[model samples]
Target: MKKQELIHLHGLLAQVQNHYEEETGNDVEHDEYASVSVRPTSIHMSKDDHKDAVFALAAGITSELADEATEQVPAAAD
Candidate 1:
């Protein structure tokens, strides 16, 4: 993907994180992402930096969702 496209995706993921937190009243634990200290608006940063941030952020968000999914009980079909 182009650098601009990657940055756009990064921004979208950040918005997803914010929306999830707002709805659930819980924070997305993106420790690795935080360590990178790269924001979507960090246009001065390299493409690789944004790529790393995107992966870390996506992993954190998906991990949380996966955990939540596991706690639910699916209905049995007749």
Candidate 2:
């Protein structure tokens, strides 16, 4: 995953975990089949995204930022 996407996903997952911890007072870990997870996993892009829209949205936003960054670079010629 891209840097921005990783950061975004981490933050969102953290939020989910924190909330779950507060509510259930348990580990609140997502199983292997979980859609969105705070922890890393082994899977394809579409598979993971299909499992979790929150993950997909974060990844999409980060991708948009990356694309914008590429366009923001200044040309060398005057």
Candidate 3:
């Protein structure tokens, strides 16, 4: 991956992690959204789903970064 892609990926990962932390975060042992028990379940965010969400988040952030980069580029002096 290119440097821009890597930076965008990192930023997206951080944003998703932060959102998750906010959603089910507290001084508790375990939250259902973030549970890890060996048992049959049907309602849970699977690994693949989580990765997909991360990817989506990363894409959005990358677009924003690209926009900002474009705005920052100095125009040629005419």
Clash pairs for candidate 1: none
Return the TM-score for candidate 3, rounded to 2 decimals.
0.40
The order by descending TM-score is 1, 3, 2
Which candidate leads the pack in TM-score?
Answer: 1
- When 1 and 3 are scored with TM-score, the better candidate is 1
Candidate 1: how large is its RMSD?
A: 2.7
- Tens digits of per-residue lDDT, candidate 3, 1-78, equal 543444455455655546655764622212332332211122243544444444555554455456556876666988
Clashes (backbone N, CA, C under 3 Å), per candidate, total 0, 0, 0
Candidate 2 ranges beyond 4 A from true positions? 29-78
> For candidate 1, what is the total of clashing residue pairs?
0
TM-score of each: 0.89, 0.34, 0.40
CA shift of 13, model 1, Å: 0.1
Model 1: runs farther than 4 Å from truth?
73-78
Tens digits of per-residue lDDT, candidate 1, 1-78, equal 989999999999999999999999878887999998999999999999999999999999999888877896879999
The lowest-lDDT stretch of 10 consecutive residues in candidate 2 is: 38-47
Q: Quote model 2's TM-score.
A: 0.34
